[model samples]
Target: MAKHSFEFKKKVVLEYLNGEGGTPYLSTKYGLGSNSQLRKWINAYKEFGDAGLMHSRKKECYSFDYKLHVVELYLTSEVSYQELAIQEGINNPALICNWVNRFQVAGLDALRSHKKGRRKTLDKTNSKDATQLTKDFTIDTSMEHVRELEDELLKLRIENAFLKELRRLRLEDEAKTRDLLGSSTVSEDNSN
Candidate 1:
């Protein structure tokens, strides 16, 4: 469905035409996404009159040959995308521009529509034998377990070092406190 109604678009374009506001102002006032949309509406209204501002729902899919022809016309002539779009009865000018760009970059093969969506994704999980799946899962799980154990071991080592440093610092603090107080409270543990 079109975002803006034909009546709303016509009203906006007419408002612009009647010198009410520019594209930005009218677009903002009416919350019509962007000024480009308003400009498109205005241009459509001017070029094709009322029919241009109307919401065109039926998307016409051109053949590969027709697309190639359009691209050829675009390259060989000095026509703008919008003009060529109108000539070719295409709804959007960007489609022509896309075709031209693809043709320029990758030549004719790019114009042909490739299969849409992720090519059925090779159903690897379903296609594999149960034993194969189990083996893969077991290996992955074991590796994950190994990584987790390594992480935990590293954490424990860090904690142990921190505790040792803390104990040393506390003993030093106790020594300083005892020396300041002139008390010989020997806190040294002889057990290694």
Candidate 2:
């Protein structure tokens, strides 16, 4: 099963603390590993508030800032993913490339691991920029752009054809009117 986010964990912790349900009940409800894990979240939440609950117990050698720096290096420097992986002692070059691509497409938030116990590194500016980049990229690559352009061209072509046909009909009507007037004048002259 996929891991839950810190927000989800915090929510569960809050629910448990509110006396909304028992720990065993929560464990079963949320499909948690054990009752102890639920207890740990409650204790952490009580001790450090929401932030404490979001903190991961696992030791991280790399900080969020460090990961951002690494991603910037890869993007700005055009460094190969394999070289970056080797330099960072990362086993998977493909993972590094994915991180770089995601950063380009989605910004700094994409570099974060989606593990449940991991705290999300939330930076307002970075998050906004990432979101904007994602929006822009999505707009550019979407089929909607092509469809809109096609629709406009079609409308323009239809209008042009309509105008041409209207002009032709108007000219034909004028010619018939002139012919009718000319024949009537000739007949009147003969009658006179």
Per lDDT, the best of the predicted structures is: 1
lDDT tens readout by residue for model 2, 1-192: 327677888889878878889999999899996997777567556655665445455544566556766665565454677567656755445666766677667654565566678786755667779899889889887876785576456445545665676788899999999999999999999999
TM-scores of the candidates in the order shown: 0.51, 0.28
Tally clashes: model 1: 0
Q: What is the C-alpha lDDT of each candidate?
A: 0.77, 0.69
The window of 10 residues in a row where model 1 has the poorest summed lDDT is 183-192
Residue 129 lDDT in candidate 2: 90
lDDT of 1 by residue, 1-192 (tens): 877788888888899999999988998999977898888777777778888877676766788878877876776567888888788777678989998888667665677777877665534555457678789899999998986686456445545665676788899999998796664334343332
Tell me each candidate's RMSD, in Å, in order.
23.8, 26.3
- For all candidates, the clash counts are 0, 0
**Candidate 1 residue runs with Cα over 4 Å from true position:** 113-192
Q: After superposition, how far is residue 183 of candidate 2 from its true place, in Å?
A: 99
